[model samples]
Structures are given as C-alpha cells and as structure tokens.
Target: MKQMTLKTTSDLSLAIAKDRFSRGTLWRFPARVPLLLLVTGLCLQMPAVWAQQQETPGKAAIPQESPFGTYGSFEKLLQAAQGGDADAQVKVSLCYGKGIGVTQDYEKAFTWAMKAAEQENAGGASIVAGCYLQGKGVEQNIPQAIEWVTKAANRGDVMAQYNLAATYYEGLYGIPKDEEKAFFWAEKAANQGDREAQCLLGVCYLTGKGVTKNLEKSAYWSQKASDQGAPAAQRNMGIFYAMGLGGLKKDVNKALELWKKAAEAGDSEAQYALGSCYAGDVEYYDPDKIYQNMPEAKKWLQKAADQGHERAKETLERLFHIKASS
Candidate 1:
C-alpha cells in the first residue's frame, strides 16, 4: 500500500443572514356583500382600530381567526403594527417585503421594520440592518446597516453578533477587515451559545487570527459546536480526530463517523474528506475496507466535485484517468 500524505486544511466560516417572512391571514368576505361596500367599510374602520392598537405597541398581535382556525393576516397584522406592536410591525414588514398578502412594497417594509427597531426589538433591528445591507426595501446603506446591526448585537441578538463578526472578518460592504473586532464579536456570540460562532471561534483559535494559536482551545470550541450538530464543526472535529491534532486522540473510526454525519448534511468538504479516506489517503488508517470498495471513493468524490470542490475535481479526474488507462 502506498503511504499518502494528508493535506492540511482550515475551515473559514462565512456568515450570511437569511431573510424569512411570516405567513399572511386568510379571510374572505361573503360573496353576497358588495365589493365596493366591503372596501369602504374596511377603510372606514381600519384606521380607527389601527389607532387604538398603536397606543400599545408592546402588546402581542392577536392571531386572526379563519376557517382554518388561528392564522396571520396581512390586514390584521398591519393594523396591529400601526398600533405599535413591535412583533406585529416586524411581521407586517415581512409581509410587505415578501408580498405575502399585499403587493411587494419595500418602502412599506422599511417603514414597519424601522418602527419595530425604534421600539428596541432585537429581531426588528436585525431585520432592518439586513434590509439596509441588501437594499431590500430601502436604499443600501452600509453605515446604517452596521449601526443597526451593532444595536441588535448589543441587545444580545446572536445572529446579529455573528453577522457583525463576519462583516469584520470579511471587510464586506466597505467595512474594513479587523480580525480583532471579528474575534471580539465572535466571542460575544459564542458566549451567547451560538454554535456558528463557536465554530468560527475555533477556527480563529486554530489560525491564530486575533488570538494566540491554541490547539486545545480550537478543539474545545469545535467540540462545543459539534455537539450542537453544526456540520462545519463536526467536519473540523473529524479532521482533528483523524490527525490526532488539537489534543484529540487519533481515532479513524470516530473521524469517519463525524465525516459521515457532516457529509449527509451536504457539507462538500466533508464529502471530499470522506472520499479521500475511502481512497486510502488518510495515513495509518486501515485500507482493507477502502481497497475492497473503490466505488465508494468515486461516489463521495463525485458528490464533492459536483459542488465545485477543486481538489475533489482534480482527484476524481486523476482517479478515473488512472483506472481507464489500467
């Protein structure tokens, strides 16, 4: 058996904020009612009801009743939002931004989201920051986005903290790359029990980015995030176990198990690593299973290659070329 050298690799975590919208209410007026009359009645009553609701913005929005039972409705939600309900305001913002029950209106979404943020709602502030970042319903303003995200992070919003950390790390949207600030924000989110941040902090420790290189700390944070079912963390832990680095005992079986879990979760890197192991690239590991199952190597390698993994692509090309020639 040929002894193969393992490639040293590091996982760099990138955080991307995802926007999610809430469902809208489903209400239908009786067909017997004149459409004009129904619209007129709603217009006349909605403002007064909205004004009453605005007086207590802290109140939770009441769920609308429908034939399907309790559900969210755009009109009812907007009414509650106008009444000063932060959660409702956020929901209305989502509805407007996503065109849930009304026409897609970025301006309206920005207005409602800003209103919720003004009330010091963490989620609302995060959404506002995301909107500013992406120019979803407002003009793209990096400074404003950073300010709103900072507020949300200060309010202990884990995702906001993670976003801020990534922003600092990547120097995105005119933000200067500052590893120290990145580490600081990542630590804050990690302390708040954000698994992504924990994994990022582990990477930071391993790379000595804004901190001293410490394998033990790397292993510690990676294990913490791994225990939370973070695929990236699991993959990193698998690498550590395989290489006996980060104060972990070398355990090929454990490495395989972790890689399998991460691979199943669609992690291309883990798929590549698993493929490498199956191809007998992991030094000192048993090669019997791998030798008996070359197709398994190709399967995992193909999966990784399909995801645009350069190394996997190179390996697979070389592998098949050699097989064809033989």
Candidate 2:
C-alpha cells in the first residue's frame, strides 16, 4: 500500500485562513482585522454577519445582508437596540463599526456592543473582544480581549470558540502554546458546526495534538467538514481514500472525486494531486489508463505550479519536460 505525508501544522494554518476568506465573512475593527503571524500555527480570521455565503470562485460571493436586518433602516435598528433587543444592538454596533447606514464610529460601536454584552449576547461579547484586540475604540489589551472572547466561547459563540482555539494554538498574546486548550476550544466550535474548526480538529486528531492520533476520528471529522464543501477537508478525505487510511478501502476513483472538488475550490495541493493522478504511469501515483489525459494533467499542474507548489513544478519538469514559471 502507498501513503502520502500530511500537511505540516503551519501549512494547515494557512489553509484554515484561506477557508475563512472563502466563507466571505466580513468585519472591520477601524481597519484590517488583527491576526498574529507567529511561529506557533493556527491562523484565524474573524467572522461577522455582514457578508453572504460564498458561492463560486473569482465571483462576488453573494448579496450582502442589510445591517438593519428586518428593520430595514438604521433609525429603526437603533430604536430596537434602545428597546433592549440584544440582536438589534449587535446589528447597530456593526452599523457603526462598518459605517453601513451610519457614520463610522468605533466608540459608538463599542458602546452598542457593550449594551448587547450586558444582555449576555455571545456574539456581542466577541465583538467587544475585537474592539479590545484592535484598539478600535478601547485601549489595546490582550488580557481583556482574551477574557471577553473566553466569555463568548463559554456562551457558545462558534466564531469566538474558533478564534480562542487559534489564539491558544498560536500562542498569541505572548502566552505559551497550550495544545490542550486549543483542542478544547476547537472541539467546542467544531461540534457547533464551524467548517474551519472542524478541519482544525481533524488535523489535531490526525497528528495526536492534544489528543491521541486516531485515524478513524480524523476521517470522521474530515468527512463531515468535506461534506460541507471545506476544501482542506476534501483534500484530506481524498488522501484517506487514496491510501486506504481510516478504515477506507483504497479507491483511486473515489480519491479523484474528492480531489477534483478541492481543486475546483482552488486548493493548490489538491490541484497538484489531481494533475499527478492524470499524468501517465507514475509508480504509486495513479491507476492505469482509466485516468490518463495529458491535457488535463498539464492544465491542473500549471495551475498548481503557478501557485508555487514545488511538487507540481517538479512533476511538470520531469514528466512532461515542460517549464512552469513560478
């Protein structure tokens, strides 16, 4: 039987961030969202309510939702917020924070978010944490940010849980990497149905980080996330089927099916995998003539190599004697 190496933790972190952007989540804390780029991995991007679900690559995701929700106007939203509607208060905060139907005012945003938080809104606590994290309307305080986000996570905010997990995983805020806490928060968000968190949890299980290495559990989470169109999980599932890991029988066709989905989603590694599969007669690389087409191989390999995937470039150079510019 043949086996392929799993992605390193940092590479997987990059994939997780890509997945967040793929979801089309939008938020602004005065400027760019705060994400620590450090040696300890787990990349994270905050998610908010403004953006729509992503539909296709290279296209505007979908129609952005109105910040006012059913109220249809900022005035109506503010009125509702003043009336102590926690959900409306959160929307009002976004209106101020993002300047949607209101002037950009981080102070007002913080105030509105605090009102919602006082009402015990989980999402509102997360918003307040972002304020502290970015120093948007509050003094930058990592401790306060962590405290607020932890509150949100305890209240079952999925994004807050995912963010907390990434923070601990990356040892952000100068804290030591705590794999146990990372796994704890990741499990919370993954179980609450976050695709990125699910992918992270799968990788954690696969690598025995904060848990025993359990291929079956890894496959279970990967399959769930892949079913939700997570490209990273799709690629992982493709490898699982290809190598007969996690109780799966080796099935090249099944592997191609999964890899094609991830490749179309713009995963360079998956594109390389697909191109490699379509190339002719490499030992332990692919099945026989059932999946050979040089044109398809070149097309996918070029795409991967364009993204600077070394293996794709090497394969194109060695097998087809073609130079792929990086």
Candidate 3:
C-alpha cells in the first residue's frame, strides 16, 4: 500500500487537512458540477507535500505526525493544485468557506479565494464576494461584494450572475432596482446553465417583470430550467402540465416526472403534488405506477406538510386518520 504525508507547517498541507467533502450522493445535475467547489481544498494541497517528502527520505521521512495522514481520495489532484492549478485554487477556497469536507476556516477561504480571484477565476470571485457580503473573514462591505460579483458575472460565472441580478433587483447596497439590469444579469446566468436563473427568468417572463409577457417564452425557459433539475422549474412545469398551458398538449407522465424530481429535491409543492397524484383516481391516470404504495404517498405528503404546504397539511391529516382506522 502506498502512503502519503503532509507537514503541519505547510499552507498547502493545512488546506488538505481542511478539505474533506466528497459529495456523498446529494448532487445530481450539470449545475451541481460546482459542488466541485467544495472539492478544491482536497484537490489543491496533497501532492506536492507527498512528492517532497518522498524525495527526501523515502518511506521513513513521511510525516505521520500531521493531522492529514488519513486522506486517501484524489491526493494526486491536490498535489497538482499545490503546484499552482488555478481551478484548484478556486476549489480550495470554496472548501474553506463552507467547511464542506473539512474544518470551516474563513481566513483560509478568503486568502485562497482572493488568490484565485486575482487570477480572474469567476467562481473564486463569486465566493469571495459572498465572504465580503457576510463579513466572514473580511470586513462587511456591500460595495466590495458587488464589485467582486460583477467581475465574476461579467466573466460568466452563473452563480455570480444570479447574485448580481438579486442585488440589482432588490437595490441592495445602494444598487437601484433596475428591471432591465435584473433581466440582463439573470438572463446571462440562465444562459450559462444556472437552473435557478432559468426558473427565475421564466417567472420574469411569465409576469412580464423585466421583459414583455410571453407565455410561450415562459414555458420555454421553464422547461429549460426544469430539464436541468431546478426544483422551482419542476414545480412550474408540473403546474403547466396540469393546466395544459403553452400548447404543451398536457402529458400526465411528464408532469409526474417533474413532480418526482422536485419532490426528491425537497420542494414542498412537489411533495403536495405527489400526494395529490396518489389520492386522485383519474380515469386515465395510473395510480399504482404514479403513487404505487400508499406508504410512500404518506411519507411525501408528510414531508410537504412539515414544510407548511397547506394543502399537504390537510391531506396528511386526513390520510393519517384513514391509516389509523385501517
């Protein structure tokens, strides 16, 4: 078995010790690729230390005394980052901020994110803005946050674009609520594969917030967002499918799929839909295939109820009583 070691004094070594997240199973979308955001710490710091230690004293010189002696995944990738991988720099910074797989340390997060931002990494700039906004490791400053977010948004960081849109829409931190600016930033983010932005843009289209009202455009954007697994989009699509809007031709199967995706992602509306789907005995609907077992139906309904969905709350109470009697 090959072993790797890190020294306690090395900045790279400390970063490796802090990044431990591996995304277990909660992530499942193209947008979720940035969960790799948490992966940066582990990716940036392990290899160089190993190489240096290996070169010095073979197996004997490897420091087992350091706290990171046990990490085994992606050590080589981390080493590459330690050697100055820009992508790795951003990832490590994210890990520091969220404490995703490692100990939460704002100072390290700020430092690493700043390093990547200086290199013009949009993702890094977004995270750094978040830190500034929240006063995490740096002093709170909305102007600074906006500057960083704008930089990243301009560079096509979808998350940054979304934040920028929110800032402009709310007029937070002296920014005026310019609908055009909101639309501009949100559209930019949506185009860059941000599911939330897609859904928000769809909503904007539906309400004619920034752009003129266009139901077809709304449906188009909603579908785009839904396909990428946006919970809000799933809910919107489910509603559309249920209502047969925008020339959709109303497919129950498609509606069910969107609801399922939304429910799995913990959307209360989707959970309620799942309950409703099970309880309704429509002539063409396959209750067995859609809701299948009553127990799962109850589980989802209860989850929605807990989230304060009124319809779900009422449904769950009735279902619970029926189950008790049965």
> Which one is best on TM-score?
2
Q: Candidate 3, which ten residues in sequence have the lowest lDDT sum?
A: 8-17
In lDDT terms, how accurate is model 2? Answer: 0.69
Give the clash total for candidate 2: 0
List model 1 lDDT by residue over 1-326, tens digit each. 44445555354331121100011111111111111121111211110001121111122233334311123455775677788988777666666655667887878877887898899977678667767766766777778878998998888776677777766766666779899998998899788776767877988898888899888998899898888777778888888888788888888788889988988877777888888788875574675433535688788878888877777787777766522211
**Residue 61 C-alpha lDDT in model 3:** 24
Error of 2 at 59 (Å): 17
lDDT score, candidate 1: 0.65
Give the TM-score comparing model 1 with the true structure, all chains together.
Answer: 0.76
TM-score of each: 0.76, 0.80, 0.62
List model 3 lDDT by residue over 136-170, tens digit each.
77887777877887888787766567666655655
Query: Of models 1 and 2, which has the larger lDDT?
Result: 2
Per-residue CA lDDT of model 2 for 46-87, tens digit only, reads 333212222212112223354354676789878988999887
Alpha carbon RMSD to native, model 3: 15.8
Give Cα-based local distance difference scores for all models: 0.65, 0.69, 0.58
Query: Between prediction 1 and prediction 3, which has the larger TM-score?
Result: 1
Better of 1 and 3 by lDDT: 1
Poorly placed runs, candidate 3 (over 4 Å): 1-105, 169-178, 281-299, 316-326
